[model samples]
Target: MCSRYVGFILLVWFPGALHAQSAARHCPAPALVGGYFVPVKETYSHDFQLTYACENTYKPAVEGWWATSVCQDGTWSHTPQCIDEKGCFPPTIANGKYTHASDGWYEEESVIRITCDKGYEHKNNLATAKCANGTWSSLPTCEQSIKTCSMPPKVPHAVIVHQGYLELFPEDSKVHYECKDGYRMEGSDKNPIVCLAGTWTEYPTCSKVTVRGDHTSTERGTQPGSGGGGGSRPDSGHVSVEVGTGRGHSTSSGPGTQPGSGGYPSTSDTRPIMIPIKDCGTWPLVPNGVVVVQDRMFLKFTCNAFYTQVGPEDVVCYNDGSWSQIPICKDAFCVMVPGYYTYGLRLSENQFIKEGELTYIPCEWNDYSVAVRCTDRRITHTSCCRSYDHQWKRCSIVRENFLPVGSLIKK
Candidate 1:
């Protein structure tokens, strides 16, 4: 009976103990020992799901499936592997191009240099762009260059000088401005506008000329109804005598003929005078010491009293009513004296002597003295004997050899 009882208890207890041990056997989680894993933790439980995402510029190694796995029993369903992402397409640019290419695919933070085409200018000389996460950064633009200027802006009462057949003004090209007739520039005469960096510089303006003194026109011929005997002579009598030409007269005699003195008509002749009106109008202001001589159709200017004439002196009045260029008078001054003199040479209160003025050199240093007069804008020296000295040797001095000496004569 004891043996039967002990055998029954051992049988029942041993089966129960084995059943409880088998129920306690559970899985911890899936282990990703082969490759990288998501939801990296020290421990995991059963039926745990993990979704995988690759790093920047990297993607799943496999194709056509979600990068995911789940823990079941004691192992994972799939292991995740990553590979480099595909590079961006070659960049396209307008008026520019990219350079410095590599053979392999571009990764994150990859840089590419850019360059503009010829004749095109950019803000930066060399430009660059970067790639990140399969996308490129913003690129710089390239446009047509602008280094020349068109016909410059016009100024009031001024004209721009067109240099031959040039249609456009290049950089640094100079453009000159000239004032028109009856007007003059207020600023400097040489003021000009220059092209700089595809733009024209500021241009100056022109101002009207203001005349000085009284304005009056001189009369040339006699009026029609003047009762004086100084009436205008006949066309053939005075016109030919003044102009030396007979091609401009039309003569017609009336039924009553009255002969005048000096072979001229005492009364008015009905014939029309066909004198070609050649008048240069009112004369411009003349300089000091200037003389104006006027003929029938011409005027001549001359300077007097140590003044020289500059520019055209003779002006002819054209039949179309225009005059030639006027002239100016310039003062004539003496050149500087070459030597330093202690005495004997004296000048008046005026430092500069005009032409045709007289200067004297005293006889304190020599028995002979000099009298100089300016002629033709030059000094003419003539030696005159102060007094004859027979005991002392007489010496003559030339104007060209005028210099200071320690002793005029050695005795």
Candidate 2:
């Protein structure tokens, strides 16, 4: 009787323990966009807390760089999202104030106008700051209204003609340059190099004279009479001239000595040989753009207004008949037309949306909206969603119609 009672109790307890173990829940590892979590694991037990941090130029969707979330009921309490920290902080100027006032961060590519305090003005007349990426392009500097240029740039094979020691040159100041011996000024000598608006105008260049060869020649000619009584007499015979760096001598015999009676070889005037300019052919054709020929050997690549140029802007045609580098014009921005709209966004004119951005276009006359993304100048529709009320709505549409969903748009 005692053994049977003990076995029954153990059986009941084992089953209860198994049931309790099976009741415990676990949450799968969370995937954080643009960020990562610490103490990574395949699964987390209920109520497990994990810390996460965002990458540079990205911020957590919640508040700060570092955030925490707890696993609960087979899921995370908070969804991890890291968004772009676009735009830059307000620029600080010592004696200038930005005219635009905003409580929040400024948008990318936004310009901020500045006004300097009394008795001061912005240096270089730059009174605006532009936001780019996540930083300000520049900060306007305010200073007393004084314009002076620093020491002029050093010209090759030339020196500044100054009387005394001088550090700064006032605006509208004139400076002259005298080329060194064996070198001559290439630019106009009548126009003096002047400093204007705290900057110097184009400076003259000193070009060295290139000499190929120098030669001096002397020639003597003699003629022999045909008859026995005829004697040799000096005749103006032509001499074939050979040019060389050093002195040269030429002699001519009368035509009778050659069995032919004729004057010496005719004098020929030295003429310079003309060489054709080396050409690499027409500028290379860039897709979606045109090439501007700066000169025969140099070219500048220009893309459409919304396109960006990849590779070097300026290219050179090599002597071997090839371009230094070929540039590609890629679509860089998405165009949003007028009358079409995104929810909560109003557009008075066309808007240029950047790449890697989400665009929501409301379906025609329907409350549903289509989500699209721009990649490499191509628009791809991802999903469709309906409004809460399902009422008719109009969303902003892309610039071009007839573009099938997910088709690449060629500019």
Candidate 3:
């Protein structure tokens, strides 16, 4: 309808032997000669080169319409291109390849430039080439970029600080042990040191307490000769002591039990017990309170060895029931608070509590009360009364509960 121009853009690409390949004078056919007039031009960069005036396939024997892009500035031609179905050149990208080829004869390398897939490095290179008399050249592009290991911290016990390596196992590296104060802790506290390299798979121990009477503390052991303690005492009741020594003959009453002194065992036909015993002495039948009874019941009167086992020798008869309750064997044994031993339970007679067990005793609740038999030691809030003589067995002169009037007397 409105022809802009069209010389001949028919590269019908081989066929129809009709030589008239001459036409580039701005569309000549269409004044009404036959039927081939195609003129569509937006002016070079104005892009629109599809000129076809029945030339054939690049069809357009040369009639009208042709001038895609390339003619701005000094505009003489070049930049018009269109060749799709794989002619291998500007078949895409705004489609336009045919800057007046044989039509006006204006050519530079023609046109061809396309590079996108292959690791794609986009920058600028959509080339074009048509220099066989046309002209178009400039294409080149290729791009790829992204590169990780960071871990190290925390080396306490076993000293295992991975990634950067710090391992200290059976003995390869790392070692520095130290722990003392009643001894605390066992193995692998990380780098606690010791297995510097050879034979210290794990070492940390000091838990020590020899067990003579009662003791406990544990962290671990086995260093010097290692550890050792073998004890056995049960010959009926144990008296086999090795300390002050005093067995058989004397059971307890007060002074020198003879042999090596320290006696408190007097069995007069078995009489005489005013309660005064130091070591051990006089006994064969001498007993005011020595019951080794067995049947009045099968008997389990167990007091469980205390005077420090040896044999039944000290006075004899012990497997577990030695003198059973004989307390007064004092040489030295008081402040001991573990489980309770010495006078363990008998809170009567001469007031013995070497740390006995009235349930671990610390009782103050309501502030002082349970005071059974007391004498002159003065200390009372709710209770405190004493009066035992049973026949002058002695020990009973204490009354300090509500005393204030002349403060009582009669020691």
Candidate closest to the true structure, highest lDDT: 2
| Whole-model lDDT per candidate | 0.47, 0.54, 0.26
Q: Who is ahead in lDDT, 1 or 3?
A: 1
The digit string of per-residue lDDT tens for model 2 on 1-411 reads 999999899888799787766676888887777899989899998888988899888876555668898887787777665656875655778867875534345667777877876535565334666677766664568764323455555555678776454656656778888878866676656336775534456666665554546842211111112111112233456422221111122233434343123221222323221111123322355654544446544667676434578899877643223456678766665554455434433435443444666554444433345555566655544233553322223333433333232123322
lDDT for residue 78 in candidate 2, whole number 0-100:
74
lDDT of 3 by residue, 264-345 (tens): 2223223222221111111222111122433321222212111222223223322111222332321111211123112222
Residue clash pairs of candidate 2? 237-264, 238-264, 238-265, 340-396, 341-395, 341-396
Assess the local accuracy of residue 232 in candidate 1 as a C-alpha lDDT between 0 and 100: 36
Q: List the candidate 1 regions with Cα displacement exceeding 4 Å.
A: 1-279, 286-289, 308-313, 319-322, 327-342, 351-369, 373-411
lDDT of 2: 0.54
Evaluate residue 66 in candidate 3 and report its C-alpha lDDT on the 0 to 100 scale: 32
Question: Each candidate's TM vs. the true structure?
Answer: 0.23, 0.23, 0.13
Deviation in Å, model 3, residue 399 alpha carbon: 99
Q: Which run of 10 residues does model 3 get worst, by summed lDDT?
A: 144-153
